[model samples]
Target: MSPPETDIAVRLSGVHLQFGKTRLRFDCAIGKGQIVAITGASGSGKSTLLNVIAGFETPDAGKVEILGDDVGGRDPAERPVSVIFQEHNLFAHLDVATNIGLGIDPALKLGVKEKAKIASALLRVGLDGFGKRLPPTLSGGERQRVALARALVRRKPILLLDEPFAALDPGLRAGMANLLLDLHRQEGHTILIVTHHPDDVRLLADSVLFLDGGHTLLHEPTAQFLDHSDISAVARFLGR
Candidate 1:
């Protein structure tokens, strides 16, 4: 049940962002239903790139399109993009199901069909019966799952994840990575995940975007990148 491979889910053309005197630029196109993993140093602009694509931050130059529409001028809500961050941006006051349902719409007007879809999404993320639990009561990995469930319920064509498993232990991180791959296959959503972990890139990425010094140095198939000497250099730089 892979997502339909028909169109480009995300496209960036000469995209550039700047902070004071520093600049970050990206030029790429990602096809529908593929997982693109971005890896780089802490301040290499990985998260900023995700933010720009999600329409949370406007690039200083170039064009961004999602689902065939130019979205550079659109607000975050106007773009068909969902982001899952390492912080698990769940409402502490709300229960899991409610948090996921919020992804439906802030207007609070979901039809019966939408409610059912939310329920299914929650189940898909292994939070089936824990929807009544608040964020404070959940473990780190469980909370991450909840955040992912929220993203799933949105059913957006494109998803952006910013080091969502950084807080988990090794075993837990691997499990989450597998779960992400499964969800990607089942829901057919185009996914972009940012991580410094080579294992994660090896396990989940269809392609890799290697960023260094605020620039994309390489974009290649995961296996090919692994065998490349440049990837080894990145691994050593990250102490991986």
Candidate 2:
């Protein structure tokens, strides 16, 4: 059977945010079980928009809703969301197991069940025997995979990625993209990510959102967004 049509995973209405000269206003809704891509130029507030949904930034004038609950003013930890940044936010001093275990228990305390879960998450991300290594010892892509394992273990319904693979080279980036797609298929969570990788949008996103000057320029199905004959704003972005 198909999924419910009314299941709205994220809703933002009349959101307003300003940073001196740059201001953003937005209104949008995303369906459940979708990979939505948020794309824009450098100063277009793409990351800032994700920050708002993830509860890292508060809208000056709007409501933020997730999983059918109004979560305006909620703390990042209090919300049902997980955020992964491009920096791979791993602790250098912590081992892979410790870092991944932090998702379940912040103190790094682990019991038998939690240990099993951590090990499973590790293997799921293709890091079977690397759990004892420190963050600094892992390659750039491995570090990203470790971060993905941590995010997956959170078991949150919504995952927000702010260009999580932006720093990787082309080959490594493609591999990580496939890994992410595999994980997304298994988890079936609602994913909203900020990325410049056209390959990612083509491979994973069901919808594409374009933003500029703190405002939503367009929100359309992935195919429609790409096929439109008059996306001057987007065309210029691609240097076409």
Candidate 3:
């Protein structure tokens, strides 16, 4: 069952993140249950935007709100968000179940309900019956599946993924994108992903957010962005 369509799930109002000579600014609203794909050149503040939303970095100015509540001051652990990095972020010492369990409780204190949720999440990610494996024992794609499972189990209102399947081969990377589509259909969480994969964006994103030189050049529905050539950023990114 999908969550009810309400107000914006994520809103950044004149937000700014400043490094030595670079400043990333955004003023936008992502509707509830929308999947927005973010793409840009490597240092275009794509990941930094997600980091700011995830509370890893506080913006230099403006409000960051999620689920209609201002959350600029929230800690990473306190925000209504979950994140999956390009790195699977699995602990080498922890087994799959234990690593996933951290989502339920960082202390790994699992009761029956939490264990059940972990199993369900693993099943959702297509990693059923593989809970005993450690990170090193899993393939690159399988490791990403574990990360997805962890994010899903958190049941946060928003989820962010940074180059989620970058390490996988082409076929495997596509498969992970399909899995994400299916999971989003089932869970209905608002999702923002930073990736350079055109196929992933073409196949899954509801909207395309194009960023360049610290500014968002366009935010449009995927089809319009791809079909309309008026946006030079999209054309340049597509090598057209």
Candidate 4:
């Protein structure tokens, strides 16, 4: 049977954010299970937008919804959202198994069923036997897989990735992108990734969101956006 239609995963209506005197407003809707890439210059507020969705930053004025629930005033954990950042954010003192297991609950007590679930998550990310190793001992790619595994364990339908692969080499980056695509397909998670690389968008994004100076200037399918002359100009500006 075909998969069920995705309810809207994220929606922002008349969203406005202010940092002191400067303000940014934009409207956007991200479909469920779609991989949307947010791209722009350094100060374009791509990260800010993701933060707003993840409830890390509240918009000054607007409605924010995730999975059809009004999440405007919800805490980050209260929203059905997961975020992976550039820093990896793994606990240096914990073993990989403990780290991934913490995704389910940071309290660290798990029943047999929960332990099995954590093991399955590790296997899904190709880290089955590496669970006992420390995060400091793993390669960059391996560490990232652990991070992805954490997101998987959270079982949230909405995911926000903030330059999660920015520090990897070209080959590793490609691998991580492919891994993300695989996870998105398997889990049917709605994802919004903050990135500056056009090639990354081309490889993994179903839709593109271009932000310029804190405003969303373009939002369309990846192919359609790439074909637009104005978007191409912006892509050129980013050296894509």
Best by TM-score: 2
Off by over 4 Å in 2: 1-5
Candidate models: Cα lDDT each:
0.86, 0.88, 0.88, 0.86
Clashing pairs in 2: 24-214
Tell me how far the alpha carbon of residue 23 in candidate 1 is from the true structure, in angstroms, after superposition: 1.0
**Candidate 1 C-alpha lDDT tens digits along 36-120:** 9998778888999899999888888999988888897899998998999999898999888788888998775878887787788
lDDT of 2 by residue, 1-240 (tens): 223537889988899998998778988888898899999788888998899998888888989889879998789999998888999899999999999999998987799999999899999999999989999999899999999999988899999999998889989988998998899899998999898866788887899988976789889898887776577878765556
The deviation in Å at residue 232 for candidate 3 is 3.3
User: What ranges in model 1 sit over 4 Å off?
Assistant: 1-6, 230-240
139-188 per-residue lDDT for model 4 (tens digits): 99999999999999899988899999999999999999988888878999
Residue 89 Cα positional deviation in candidate 2, in Å, after optimal superposition: 0.6
lDDT of 3 by residue, 1-240 (tens): 223436589888899888899989977778888899998778888998899899998898999988878887789999989999999799998899999999989998899999999999999889999899999999999999999999988889799999988889999998999999999999898999998877788998999888888877778888887785676767767767
Q: How many clashes show up in model 4?
A: 0
Let me know the TM-score candidate 3 reaches against the reference structure. Answer: 0.95
Better of 1 and 3 by TM-score: 3
List ranges where model 4 is wrong by over 4 Å.
1-6, 231-233, 237-240
RMSD, each candidate, Å?
3.1, 2.2, 2.8, 3.0
